[model samples]
Target: MESNDELVDGMIKAMERLKSGDPALNTLASYLYKADHRLYEYLDKLKIYTELEKPTPQQTQDAGKLLEKIVFLLFKGLEGLQSVKSFQSAGPQYDLLVSGDDIGWKVVCKTLYLEWENRDIVIEAKATKSPLEDKQFARLCSIMEHNLRGAGLGIFVTLNGASGFPKRDSTRQRAVSDCRLRQIIFHARTNKIIVVLDKEDLFQLTKNGTLIEILIRKIRDLSELSGLPTTPAEQFQEIDLPTHLKMLYHSNG
Candidate 1:
């Protein structure tokens, strides 16, 4: 590792540049650097990631890095969940993997605690601006099945949401339909859950509920939509959804 003096000097220089380079980020950075660093209060830090996100049709290295950072913050900031490890390309195919435990009992609702406790959470990111295609989603499933075996849950964090529609060719809706069909198959075969969330969904979630609460809702909603119920159905209770999340959950279903 570099000398401590070098690290401190680097931090000082980076802070100076941040103050001059980006006014908004400079403000956030100062707040974080000075504050108590409590995770609950730090939840607001998502603003930085949202501000930096600039999706393009062509994927860029910055897009992937931003997403990885966002997901890492989410797993750590959300009440009750704990991040066990994160892998960009070093671990499995997962971007960030968290293991849910009872530690969330203090900060999360009891229902969420019981559901997620002891389960493994897997997240995959797509930085491109286009909706996730069937093939792309299938890759996530394949990874979960073969690589991260026994992982209880999976999420697709996409910029443009997932594709699945009816009566269309491979362009849009048809791609969505294929993804849904695969979801059903995967759930039936493995009895696990995977859901998709676009950047907009992430933004709305910041308003609807705590990070973990919204995630619970999304997981159950996906399980219900798949028609292989019993678990998500009986265990899930009705809660008013933010209009955006409601619409995005299963648009063509």
Candidate 2:
């Protein structure tokens, strides 16, 4: 199992690779907002874990100090970011209109694609906790129909638990069906919405322990499946427990 530093480094490497020319750049470029939130949360968690009285003094101090350094570097990187959507489009003034008639909402998505070959892809990234709301989904479907000629795709990417539908259950199935019906009514042209959940994916941070190891493994699989290059994704540095954190672990000594 890898550690926290490995995970952050992997994500950074993946971002660099994506920038170098990952087709999914379409989706990856807009993930900075969620990434920022995750990193920030990690910093907070480390502080709390260190301050807990149950841990030995050494462990507490080591984890806290290491995490503090990580936090500092993250903020430094964040400060350099122009906006959450800075990497979305090639230049300023680029616009992809997403509007719906029945939904009474409009959004100009960053890095939106109206058509890809014979299909259209309307992409939206939102920070809301409820991406499945009727109005919101309706707006997305309507926008696809009105703007993309109904034959494209609707992609909603959200942070935390916002973008995914609930797991299937007898009672929940009814609601899901209703939502599908409403989506059809609004879309009238296209029939699919691809939702991506960042929070769901965040499990990799803890489960794999190192961000890079998990990401590298996932990217390797994806590359094999999609025929994308895995070199850059595999080139990241290994995770190291920061000096402060190691010190905390040895504090009792």
Candidate 3:
């Protein structure tokens, strides 16, 4: 069995190789592609070990934290490579203007605008250890549209895996229905939603290259709200993983 130390060392090496553009970058990419699969494998084994037991509340919380960390890391990695500015905006009225009647109320416009090559995106990072409901997902979408009009993208980082949930599962469906593959136009004018599912769901999707292409294409399109072309290669070129990872390591050090 690979010891935890061994795994850590291997991961560090892989990340470094990727940063240096080593020929081994290909291998590292393959490994990352399987990350969700390995995570699911471990989860399945854990499920077997706890056959008669349900995950405790505290255990669920811990699991949620772990998943959140993974999503955060993924975003950080991608952000590093891109040439966009991203920072947490003020508060609820991050963007847009809301108005009531003549003597009514209005939310101040956003600090950022949807200018060419400059897009504003709001990210809501959340975690769930169990099945999620439709109301929760719908609520997220509503918040994005109502408050952030020129918002080009809305990303939902979810843990506790959304797979095994049915399509007819109104809750799961609603969670992502706003951006179905066929409903492309609707997202074009508004925030294109991206649900980064837990490790398990990500793994299953990898079995089909087509699915990966679809997701990349969708994200590419969403990213283009800044007047960029919709291309995965171009998007990645915009990501600066090497520098970002170095900063992360030094900060922790």
Mind giving the per-residue lDDT tens digits that candidate 2 earns over 153-253? Answer: 44443333232233312122223333434543443344343333233343333321233232333323222222121222223432224688877776886
Best-first order by lDDT: 1, 3, 2
Q: Runs in model 3 with CA error above 4 Å?
A: 1-53, 79-118, 160-191, 201-214, 217-253
Candidate 3 lDDT by residue in tens digits, 1-253: 9996577446644354232223343233322222233444444443443342567777766655554444433333321123223344454522111122110000000111123222434554455544344455555466566755644445444444233232322331222232232224435555345343433333333231222232343454443432222233223334324677868865856
| Model 1 Cα lDDT, one tens digit per residue, 185-243 | 88788777777766654554332133444455555555456332112212334544668
User: For candidate 3, what is the total of clashing residue pairs?
Assistant: 7
RMSD of each: 15.0, 17.0, 16.6
- lDDT value, candidate 3, whole model: 0.38
Index of the highest-lDDT prediction: 1
Which candidate, 2 or 3, would have the higher TM-score against the true structure? 3
RMSD over all Cα atoms, model 2: 17.0
Sequence-dependent TM-score of model 2:
0.31
Runs of candidate 2 exceeding 4 Å displacement: 1-116, 160-164, 168-192, 196-198, 202-253
Model 2, CA-based lDDT: 0.37
What is each predicted model's overall lDDT from 0 to 1?
0.53, 0.37, 0.38
